[model samples]
Target: MNELLKVNYDSDRITLSARELHEFLGVKTKYKDWFPRMCEYGFSENVDYRLVAQKRATNNPKNPYTEFNDHEITLDMAKEIAMIQRSEKGKQIRQYFLELERKWNSPEAVMNRALEYSRKQVQALLQTNEKLELENKIKDQQLNELKPKADYYDQILQSKSLVLISQIAKDYGYGAPTMNKKLHELGVQYKQGGQWLLYSKYQNKGYTHSRTINITRSDGRSDVRMQTEWTQKGRLFLYELLRKNGILPIIEQN
Candidate 1:
């Protein structure tokens, strides 16, 4: 609003009138707070506030101007004054002003503009977060819907009725170890019971049913049975096995 002050937007520079500089440096006692505190550190007002040759010539010439405004102040002039006032006590104040000027004119302003752009991008992401979450939920529901049908096919292959490991190996056209590994991957369990029974399912003759087999242990001491029905004991045993192996998935209770 001051007539003698002009701000250049393209250069980001401010031109200050002599009167404004005098007022800012507190040449008058009314605005003492605006004065640089270096005035206390051997910074006599006479040395810091002086009239430049150009500023001396005014329309009146009789009353030579002794002050210059912020725009009239150059970077070199500010640095020179700061260097003269350099002392342990004034170091912080000097550095503060130096850094303030550096930030105002340096590439940091560009960085701040970039930071503002990134903040807007983050705001946009947050705005659509709910829609993204809803899409994820729909995908999860579709996965859940297809899960039972896949489980049905898996049950047919791992039927508990296929007692002997060799039988499952024969049906699946895989080796015993491969069959065992497949069953292990599918979380199939074998139970010791009245007879050697196989409980895995096999898709045969256009129908899927539990396959059963009767067999004796190699030692003749125990009979084993495999089944698809997951019992409380079976579940507990499976849970313990998985826990021991560190493969257990967390189960939520109703």
Candidate 2:
């Protein structure tokens, strides 16, 4: 029922003039300078205040016909002004302004903002879901291309056996270096002595097989060297590991 509370308090288009505001709250400060300083303190025009041209007082001899700018402030801006005034009247009006604000910003206004935010969040989630579906379609298409060959290997993978590096590459349609790179990524490091050995954690894990081969050097010296192969379990393990990571092996046909 207060004079300040009686304005065109439209839900989304609420505003009040500076003169009307000062008169209602009994603010006697020279507001011409004060309002600009208040705006400088992070209050934005149109968002917090709007400057409008009003005709000067008819009694003014020199400026009666001229237009002067008056600020039409939002409730939020009025509250800010009340907070900055260093007087008991300021404190009283601040409390009164708070009550007015509660009436204006309570239930319905708060719900409108909340609903708008929820709508945006839902739209974002829909966009993200669409992107994921597109990626899944591409991945499914790639997997379909490999399905015919992958079916045969799926059978061979069930047998208990050890295969040489060359055989592994041949079966998986990859180079020896690429096979080794994948093994390394799976935490299977080549030993320091230039022999392919599983790391200590994978030792005796039935992931590897080895053999010794004798070769004569250029100096007519023959040395026995060890060669490592992948076990059936190891092959199956690598296959699944590579497949799950989006790496598809080219299937070799008989």
How many residue pairs clash per model?
Answer: 20, 1
TM-score of each: 0.21, 0.38
Candidate 1 residue lDDT tens string, 1-254: 22222322233342233334344333434333433453444433333343334344556667766544232443334444435544542354345446555666678786776777798889999879978999999999888865754553454445543234554354335576665565456555333453222244421222222344455888886554543333333333333444466542222111
Single out the weakest 10-residue window by summed lDDT for candidate 2: 4-13
> lDDT for every model?
0.45, 0.73
Q: Write the per-residue lDDT of candidate 2 for residues 29-140, one digit (tens) a residue.
A: 6668656777887988767777888885677776568776788888777777777776676677678777766776789977887787798899999999999999999999
Candidate 1 segments whose C-alpha is farther than 4 A from its true place: 1-112, 127-132, 160-254
TM-score of 2: 0.38
Q: List the residue pairs that clash in candidate 2.
A: 46-49
Candidate 2 at residue 41, lDDT? 76
Give lDDT: candidate 1, residue 185: 65
Query: Model 1, residue 100: displacement in angstroms?
Result: 21
Instruction: Identify the runs in model 2 with alpha carbons over 4 angstroms from their true place.
Output: 1-150, 158-160, 252-254
